[model samples]
Target: MSGNEKISELDKVLTQFNVFGRYHCLFMFWSFLALASNAVFCSNFVFSAEEVSYRCKDEGFGNDTCTNMANSTAECSEWTYEDPNSFVAEFGLACQDWKRTLVGTMHSFGYMVGLLLVGPMSDRLGRKLSIVITGMLGGVFGVARSFTSNYWLFIALEFLEGAIGDSCSPMFILTIEIVSSRNRLLFYILCSFGYPFGGVLVSLSAWKFTYWRTFLRVIYMPALLFFAYLFLIDESPRWLLIKGKKDKAIKIIEKAAEKNKIKIDKTLLEKMECEKEKSVNFFRLLKMTFESKIILKRFLICLVWWTTSTFVAYGLSINSVSLRGNKYVNYALTSLMDVPANFIILLSQNYFKRKAPLITSFLVGAFLCLAHPFLPANLSWLSLIMYMASKLMSSFYFTITYMFTSELFPTYTRNSMHALCSSLGRIGSIIAPQTPLLMHYWSGLPSLVFGSVSLIAGLITFLVPDTADNSLPDTVKQAEEIGKKGDLKKPAPDFVIDKDKDCSRL
Candidate 1:
């Protein structure tokens, strides 16, 4: 067989192994850890910069103006914080609440900027190196931030950590790289379960360790485990082949085949090794995006959808810091919503078309958010239920955007476009921390903003083409013709994944 022909048979060769072989299990375990770490790294700000009740040193807590300075610190010569070890109290940041909000904004900014740099790094360097290196850096800087006495140093570490903390995406790419067409969704869901659990871990850790430093130590010290991944995890064979390192790719796959106790077709593998190298660069990604009108239009729409999803999703959890009930419980509940959301989304991918679920999640969430503040004090419990429900919807909306965005563009540009959309979407998370500031203007202002943007996004979602069980587009013309003519090209058997895999077993 020719190299091109052997390439199509690669899937056939891989399917000969058990679905949950030793090599696959090892990769999944590491990817799960990386994902959970990403979650904690991003959401730790809620506790690290948590609100602490404070009063002027001279003014007693009984004073009318000194009750709770969560929103406004009101100039003071000295202060008494309920938790001296809290983020604001530790730094003597008594008169400024903006500094507290800045923690999340700066970290998100770092993540946004880092997203652009890391995607290219993953492509040029390889997937496993990107995950291992970034994962290790996030752990090191995170631990350093916990020990720092300087506020500026803490803030700088926040940005540095966020910038390099984007290992989840690379981990995701690597997870799918090893799986065959039939089992990709199984791996995808398996890895994503780690994110929700990460939030629960952070909240539980913060609840146990009230002090900021202790809480951080409890959260980040374990991240040191990623350093071990360098020796433990294998490099991606597919990435190696594309980069013309066929011998290295072959060696990894041979090991995997052996661990799975499956014999390999040396003849077929030899032909694959002969395939020509295909290189991808950021310049090509940029050139292709700008060169196509349909993709450009969809890209703009995707920005709105992605921005709204991140804004509302992150806003709900960030705002949970100030909820009426148990802080840890509220935060955990909000974060935990992702569990059901993922399950529902997984079901949607199999049973429903993409557009309807995307639209309903946003619209229903908007309605719940819009109605939240209007409830009477007597019905506060009902409001809390609605809040959790809204989070569930936002979680579903956020995950589905990723799947839909990949289908909107051609095969060549799909990953790059998705990464671009995700990077730019961090803008929502960047601004989400300031909702506490919005609350000062009107307690309901944040909800109003979240609801309004989500409403607009749902309406805009109608314009997006539905990609139910359709084949992914392969060319610019085929991409533009979606929702009009049928698929211009069928998907290669290599990626014709079985979408109806049983979710119950997972």
Candidate 2:
């Protein structure tokens, strides 16, 4: 057979293995576990260090009626918390309540550090290995955090957890790399389901365990299960091919084919070869990204969108403790909003295109959040409803941005751009915890700030090109031409086939 025919046959055989099947499903299940763990760790601090109603330890003050004690000369020294085991009560952070927010800020700071380090590390090592290392480290630190006797020790551990706890993004990239184009959106949604599922797990655990230390220990135990499951999986074939490990890549394909009960013809497999290209370092990638006006615009817009969405979503979530409702139930309800958010994105992604739904979600979410301050205090229920609605829309925007950003960049620099945007997004999260402090000045200041930023971000969404059904760009030049013709349904460029065939070139 001619070389072209042999290459064609190889492509067909690879597709047979790549079809959405048991292999992909299993991969997704494991990936979901990592994502769920991320969600749990990221939000668990909200409950662990939860603020509780407390009063002075003055002997004369009645436990039930401390309202009048504040006016008296009784010094407010020792305190009692509604949840005695909460970090605030245990560590006496009540008078110094500002320190409580730092628990989450430290974790986010660690995540920012991780993003800067891990993305490039994954490129040098392998995606699977990076996840395993980071996951195990995050789990270890998370477990050890429960044992810290001093507040500073606990804070230190939380920082480590934040740094290493970022396994979800790498695992996410791996799932994208392994799946077929047709299954990409479905796989992304499935993996994202873990965030809400983890939130549900957090709520259930908090309700059952009540004690902060035990809650931390129990929530982190799942990380071990996810780490163990990693052994049963293979590194991404796409990454292997990119590293010029053709034999190893084929073995993974063969294993998947065997598990999926498909036969791969040996002759066709022989024609498959990894095509190597000049290796681009992180610095070079950054240089190329900034040099291209199209990519730079998309990058900056996405950075802002990411920062805004994460800021609002996490700000609302952490700030829920201060809302006039049962904190646990409020958090769970907000977390559960992810389910409907996913469905909304799934329904609107194809029809609305990337830019429109994102803009709508941000604008609507902003309006609700901005209106929150104006509501009468008697209508606390109304404010709660608006907060939940804002969370739902922010969650939707967060989910869509993941896919939207992936579509905006070429495969060669996709991971780097994602990591950069995510790193910048962490700035929002880090700032979010501190926003609750604004309530001292005005109860609704945080909400107003979050909403206004989101409104501006939604307006900036117009600058990003719509990527509804467009093919993934394989080169910077192709990515630059994405929206030039102004047709949403423009047939994907001829590079689509090349992207699938020339994985190494990407």
**RMSD for each model, in Å, please?**
4.3, 5.8
lDDT per model, in order? 0.76, 0.76
TM of each candidate vs. truth? 0.87, 0.87
What value of lDDT does candidate 1 attain over all alpha carbons?
A: 0.76
Model 1 Cα lDDT, one tens digit per residue, 461-503: 8887776444444445556777776433224221233343222
Task: List model 2 lDDT by residue over 1-506, tens digit each.
Answer: 43223223434555555334567667767777788888898889888887677766665666634444546654566677777778888887756777888999989888877787777777667789888888888878988988888999999989887876668768877877675444456567767888988888898898888899999899887676556756767887666765678799889888888877788888767665433324777789778768998798888898898898778889988887676667778788889999988877877764666788999999999899899899998987788788889899999899888888877876556676787788878899999889878987998899899889989999989887777555555457657867877422334221122223211110
Model 2 stretches with alpha carbons more than 4 Å out: 1-20, 59-77, 80-82, 263-277, 376-381, 485-506
Which pairs in model 1 have colliding backbones?
A: none
Compared to the true structure, candidate 2 yields what TM-score? Answer: 0.87
- Model 2: which residue pairs collide? none
Report lDDT (Cα) of residue 317, candidate 1.
92
Model 2 lDDT, residue 207, Cα = 82
